[model samples]
Target: MSNRSIGLDGPLYDYLLEHSLREPEILAELRAETANLPEANMQIAPEQGQFMALLARLMGARRYLEIGTFTGYSALAIALALPEDGTVVTLDKSAQWTTTARRYWERAGVSGRIRLELGEAGNTLQALEAEGETSRFDLAFIDADKTGYPDYFEHCLRLVRAGGLILVDNTLWHGSVADPDDTREDTRAIRAFNDALHHDERIDLSLAPIGDGLTLARRR
Candidate 1:
């Protein structure tokens, strides 16, 4: 079997976006603004955001949860996809970055649908659990620090309803996870997380070869 794909090599990816991407003006503006940041790479690719939004819509997700909220592009996409009654609870520790996020959410007029929490994700997750939020979310997206991926998945698994979906970002770690000599902390953690998910029976799994790699786990 060959892993080679024409899209990764050249114009195919650009064509994919040209024909398929229907980014709202607000989202385009947000993406453009985020592109200037020093940590801009942290943003998920636009196509990936669109993909996740379609998934949320397909699953009829009414309650959404996001573990990482960098500039809020992903949240905005999900919020737009959800119905008026849908809600998204997103967690992030960066007040500075999330301030940018909040501005965009307000611009998109989805601020009311999204609740932003500023603190350690673990603390927030535990708090949600204590508030009887078990199985409360219809979908959860884990894009936080890679070291916390394992714990985040555990919490999201419990917070999201049975049969709900969990999306984990950067599972491929920019192709570094396939290189044994990398030995980076983030890479190792992602590798372990991927291995664990592959064996875990609580969910069905598929690691998609999308931007930076996205792993989909559906609770049983």
Candidate 2:
């Protein structure tokens, strides 16, 4: 058996999902509906949602922060894993998409636990920081604009308490990160962000090969 993570081919991927995935009915419905959208790829994979939910439970996460809330699948997963008192504050620029997210959140009966803030995320994050919100969150997830990752990560670090967790999505960028010839703007940004996280001294980092790629950073 290999010591490292194995590459998942079509059959292997299917096997993994069959054996490991445990998606909720509502989440599954959300996934199916999102699949028909033009920007459906922005949705996190079901397995990734499960994994993040596990992370939330393991960390005893209560106050959650999400930088991107496209259709709210990830937020819902995290919310389901949390206690009734736990809450998630999610930010997104699209009222249209988040409106759909709110509908599902309400259906899941976790609407009261999720606070959606609409508008430019960067400015919103700055406002949070300006309001003395440093070290206020237990966990922060970043899955928004690729170009804004660095800024998002910085704000997330500031918002999370010492020893809190920060989860960054799309770190692999569909494997374009490792290809020297693939210098797309988003690719370059992800690559640069990955490198910075790799060298950052304030956090413990792991680049897990889940859904495109997920980077976990625990504040030190």
Best by TM-score: 2
Clashes of 2: 0
Taken over the whole model, the C-alpha lDDT of each candidate is: 0.95, 0.95
Q: Assess every candidate by TM-score.
A: 0.97, 0.98
- Alpha carbon lDDT of residue 138, candidate 1? 92
lDDT by residue (tens digit), candidate 1, 55-105: 999999999999999999999999999999999999999999999999999
TM-score of 1: 0.97
* Deviation from native of the Cα of residue 102 in model 2, angstroms: 0.5
Model 1 Cα shift for residue 39 (angstroms): 0.2
Q: After aligning candidate 1 to the native by TM-score, how far in Å is the CA of 207 from where it should be? A: 0.1
Off by over 4 Å in 1: 1-7
